[model samples]
Target: MSSRVLLVGIVRTPRQRWTKAEELEELAELTKTAGGEVVERIIQTRSQPDPATMIGKGKAIEIRELCRRYEIQLVVFEDLLSPTQLRNLEDIIGVRVIDRAAVILDIFALHARTAEAKAQVELAQLEYFKTRLTGLGIEMSRLGGGIGTRGPGETKLEVDRRRIDQRITTLRRELERIEQERQVQRKRRSRLFQIALAGYTNVGKSTLFNRLTAGATVVSDRLFATVDASTRVFKIDKKITALLTDTVGFIRNLPLQLVASFRSTLAEIRDADLILHIADISDPKVEGQIEVVNDTLATIGAGDNPQILVFNKCDKVFDDSLFTRLVARYPSAVFISARTGAGLDILQVRIKEFMEKQMVVKSFTIPAERTELAALVYAGGRIIGERILNGKRQIRIRGFAAELMRIRKEVRKRLL
Candidate 1:
């Protein structure tokens, strides 16, 4: 059975750019995605958050009554609650009380399938609980069976700090090995143009990735449907085979625990030759979300990488005027619907054009007797034009600087 959940938030400033209502709605959506049934949303307006109960004592008492009346099994805060607040709320309301980070962590735990992804989620959960393990000994009794406890079971969580530290150390070493493996593989593909899809969560990044790579990655409307990095190959032009990676999506105010845990996974974005910043143009907060993605990229050390703004889901947009303004603002931006393949041709063309800028165009000729040398030249790059004259094969190719250099060295004796 789904847990009946109540959402609590504090509206610090009514004149804020975004309203408390919007935050609460997003919180509700997160709750639904986390498999909780939100029964009601309660907002407490205050100059500042209450140190103990978060929503203040009076509101806490009121929520206690509401919980009983509605038979609410869980209460989630839109903002993070300190250990004291979480314990106090659970004691007074006589139900499970978790903060937004916990809910997000729980969702990650739910979706994690691979060993590395599971380990990452577990590490994040432990890191979050390491500090909060105090004062909640009794309150966390219910934690033995619930969403937040998915990665680290009750037995592991109940252990002393020493055990958790040991486990964290183990996970870190494992992730290091995984990262090293990734680096070695990346070296093997150093010749390919690497592209990564980065954007706010549920912005159709996975959909676009699937469309481009002919992959079968699961696509859903829920936030964080893709929590692991998925990579595949796609052709930009006929001969330019590029590697495309779909990373876990970014979100507004993403929990620090997740960022720290998913560092290795996010390295795909950092290492990309180019980033495709996919945005849901139909969303009202699309611009804000785009900013969030940019901030996330900077945080992950991908700030300096080349990026192309891809406004996805344009088929869902009603206001073409907004799109025109967007196009005007970002002259190189591409609008496409990954679902219907609309504007995909344009996106591919734009990608090809962008990639071509980095390539070195060179002309080379190989002697007809050097059949092996001709094959090497063709393998090194896409041949734009080729002709045979004066008993020699002349070829014009566009390719990576390193590949061209290697080809030049291999065919140095066959040069014409």
Candidate 2:
């Protein structure tokens, strides 16, 4: 059964970044994503939030009466609430009250699939649970199916703080082990150039990955549909091969624990040779979403990587003039519809150009019987052609400088 949810947004004077209406709209979407139906949205304008109840005590009382009349089972706040505020609001409101952070964590838990993703989500949930140990009443913990009160919270209600802390430590150790294994693999793969896709939620990075590799990715219209990074080796024009990775989407705001736990997963983007910075051009908040991704990249120490601005979902864009203006703003950006495969040719050309710019042209010759050298050349570079000279195979190639240097050393060893 879908939960009947009442969403509350307390408007502070001169909202700094996002408007009240946008906040409420996003709140409604979040509630819906958590399998809840928003029955009402209430905006209370105030100089400041009440210390006890987020909205004033008098307003809380009135809202509680309305909830009872409407049979609303859940109330979600647009802002993060202090422990005291959460406890006091629930006591008077007579329903489950959850802040925005909890709702995001619950959605992440719901979508978690792989072991790494589950472990990360568990660690985040435990941290969130630790803070609410004292303030949220124990009785309310048993009440199920409400925002922030459901999923991992119910099973962990009885565990003491120390046990939860122990679990957190254990999870972190397990993740560290996983990260070590991944690091080893990355070291092995460093010879190959890597390109990573970083973007806001619901952008077409995964879709583009699927199209490029002929691999299936679970695509959806929901936010954060994929928590685990998806990576595949794809060839540009069937010669230049590089690792293409799809990373977890960036959001407007994330709790500190969530950010810390997910840092390991984003290491691919950090180590990438180039980043495809994708944005949903059709969304009204396209520019703001781009800024969010850039800020996240900077925070994670990946701000210096070269980027290709990819404006996806071009088919959905109705304003041609706006598109043209954006093109002028981002001269190198490629506007494409991954669904329709439109503008993909131009994107491929751009990728090839980036790849070529990173390569150093060279010429070498290998004996016809030296099949190993031929294979290495194919794996590590774009071959110009082969020639027959004095019963030997002459190869001309262009590849990354480091890879060419490595191959050159191997050839020297064989000659000696």
TM-score of each: 0.91, 0.90
lDDT per residue as tens, model 1, 1-416 = 88899988787776652576687887788788878899998877788888898888888889999999999988888888898887787778877788888888888877887777888888898889877775354735555566465563223343366678998899899988988888898887776888999999899999999999999999999998889898899887777879999989888788898899888899889989999999999998888899999998999899999999999998998897898889898898999999999999999988998888889989888787778888888998878998999999999998988778877976885564
Model 1 earns a TM-score of 0.91
Worst 10 residues of 2 by lDDT: 150-159
Q: What is every candidate's alpha-carbon RMSD to the true fold?
A: 3.0, 2.9
lDDT of each: 0.84, 0.83
Candidate 1 residue spans exceeding 4 A from truth? 135-139, 152-160, 363-370, 384-396, 406-416
Lowest lDDT sum, 10 consecutive residues, model 1, at 152-161
Per-residue CA lDDT of model 2 for 8-34, tens digit only, reads: 887776553357778778778877888
Off by over 4 Å in 2: 14-18, 143-145, 150-159, 362-371, 384-396, 409-416
State how far residue 301 of model 1 sits from its true place (Å). 0.8
